[model samples]
Target: MPLSPAFSSILEKEYEINFTQCLPSGRLKYTELCNLLQLTAATHADLGGISFTDMQEFNQAWVLSRMRIEIKALPQWKDIVTVKTWINTLENSRSIRALEIYLNGEKIIGGETFWAVFNTVKRRPEALALGHKHFELYPDLKATKESFSKIIINPEKEEVFEKKVILSDLDIINHVNHVKYLEWCMDVVDEKIILNQKIKSFEMNFMKELSLRDQVVIHENLSDNSIVFSITKENKNCFALQLNLV
Candidate 1:
């Protein structure tokens, strides 16, 4: 596995899981799990921002297209586990992001993901040529056509909520981690609704950078039992997420 130009640095974390599906006596909180995932995501993404050539006018962001997570074990609340992830490669312009979860140095679960890069102003995938200048900084990553786009659902009107960027979310990279954003947005979701039904799949799109003092407005849209969660910064759509809950 050779690295890609987009795969600039390594992102790793220690995650403790204290809940799972096996227990029914007490209770389970999906918000907690969603928060953990966001933390893990933030760990990996903060690493991606490192090799940037210029940050003044131009910045790059990743939106997840598809994900495959195979769990060999589940950790309860407060249990500490470790997570490691990176840009495995680039399929055309799409980046393949992968993660591994470990407990006491033993492999527990693994995750694989796909992503696309969006140019902030244009609000779309940045052309390879347009990004070539910064690409030079990541001479190792390759540009490709295989980068698949994440699925998204738009609604006529969205249910909105506001959240603050608290101190607990700062990663080693001086910004909010990826999983933190997910957890923040998912926190308001009614668990009875998410757990009662089965989710077929999910997609996450990261559009902007979040740091201290940032206030995010989370927007959720539900249709026929399916749902999409979009987070905004000062009104610009940053993350467009979709879930299939049946």
Candidate 2:
């Protein structure tokens, strides 16, 4: 759909890499970067007139489908970085959002995300009301990197750890928040891997929704200095994440 004449072109937010957001290496943690990305998305959505609360009123909500981030460099503790995000495309009940993270006036990270609108009552995907004036207010920004593809599961992977979904992991929708899964995946990986290598890219595919009743097992497949992690519930794939190290 074409953007409205008055649509905003972009949304940007600045954040400092603080101690709490950094890893032992003093760089932004993988999970923390994901948190920043999510926060930026929500803030931009609010500016676009579709905050989570706004969707909840209609018994609807937004769910992340997949995401990929290419990191050229990670911001260190006390370094100021800016995150810029925009809607790149919206169609077939899916919205593509692009993000760019800048450090010291230079681009350091590029990210792409796909989200789908869900009907809370029916527990299924729903088409967005793009014809609505508010939906037309999308930015013209594009991603610095290309979109990611599906992450394949290799059953030969080894089980890394198991975790239970607790009340604190649940979001307002009563489901395990997607960011929590990313944190679980990161925790299962060896800290030495994160400290000794620079993460070149990270991608995640959320295959199925997880809830408080779920007990998940994390599995890992290592190859070529890259690791692929998958969360399983009752032996079924719940989500898969891939991290490429340099």
Candidate 3:
């Protein structure tokens, strides 16, 4: 696909929050908020001629490596929110992108994402085959106050639950969707915290991809202000999530 005439380095798109995307409190669910940000980033890439369809021609696709999200507020059901996204850096097989969500012209959430180009057929990381120089980069512009960080897994973490990857967990890439990992960890969290909007920020790191029928165990490490969850398969770490409570 060619770059759209309306293409811009930074893109903003509006979404109407529906009841299905909200929590019992009518505020948007964290997973749904991530979906909106992902959608906006995809839209921007599509318009810039570097979308999944464009990269698929060369057996390549972008995969999330790490993500950091800071939230001041969550939109409620029936609210109209705008998501803005832009590339902070792009080189070789890796890129950094920033995204933000605004309600009534006030920014409420910001996200920093690290992505890597992967060979879908070969199932390995590789440099992107498509040209991306046409899209301007903003190395100095950042959406979140903090950049991406490594989420340290505690060796003393206790196993909380186990799950098998199912059809619902897979995305277009045939692996577990990144957001599903967050949902899994959230399930074990206190409902009162989520219902009362007590989450201030969170981070997720994807270490290995999980496929259908793959069984995994989730572990938890609790602290005074943060809770860390690590998922493992056959004693090997696959993913980690750290939730910073307000």
Candidate 4:
């Protein structure tokens, strides 16, 4: 299918990033960055997607699946940064998009998001080909496979999660956002824990949706610097997160 005109026009939207948003460690906080990215995506919907052009006549929303955020230096609250985003492709019911977060002339962050547009009435995925007028403006899109490794959790190490679940860990989805769960998993690994000294990659299999009031157990272990992570509730596997900590 051809690219949507709406997609191309949204690339012109203005975006700003602040330096004060950085954490005590001098890096951008995880959730803050995620929220900004969400905002950026929302703006694109307004300017590009046909779903929003019709307003009340057409009701739709995008759901995020996989996302990768990389930053050499995170901008704080006061630091000014410009962001440019583009829709890349739609294949097999998935849409891939690229976003560049820059600080001054320096490129600080380069990220990509995996999304699927859902029809409000049907509550299911929508076909990008049906977006006739939407493709005229968004012409510069090339489909490409995402570059990242998948991480797997080790079952033996997961026994550690026999503990209780607390209310603080829950989120709007009733389940925790994957990144927050990652933040928790990452905290368990210390500098001295691995001799391999490098994180190659990680992956998550969201087998079951997590909801509020549901008990959760965090299971983890260090495997030569690469830690395996898994979250369970009542012996049923809810989520599995893997980290390649080199």
Each candidate: what lDDT? 0.56, 0.82, 0.93, 0.57
Residues 82-117 of candidate 2 have per-residue lDDT tens digits of 998877787767888898999989999999888999
Best by lDDT: 3
Model 1, CA-based lDDT? 0.56
Higher-TM-score candidate among 3 and 4?
Answer: 3
**Per-model root-mean-square deviation over C-alphas:** 8.3, 3.2, 0.7, 5.6
Residue-wise C-alpha lDDT for candidate 1, range 104-216, written one tens digit per residue: 88875555666665554554666332232222223233222123345564656475778788788875445665666666656666666544434434446666667788988
Instruction: List TM-score per model, in order.
Output: 0.52, 0.90, 0.99, 0.66
Error of 3 at 222 (Å): 0.7
* TM-score: model 1 vs. ground truth: 0.52
What's the best-to-worst order under lDDT? 3, 2, 4, 1
Better of 1 and 4 by lDDT: 4
Candidate closer to the true structure by TM-score (higher is better), 2 or 4: 2
Per-candidate total of colliding backbone pairs: 26, 0, 0, 29
Clashes of 3: 0
lDDT of 1 at 152: 62
Local lDDT at 169 for model 1: 81
Model 2 residue 100 distance off true place after TM-score fit, in angstroms: 0.7
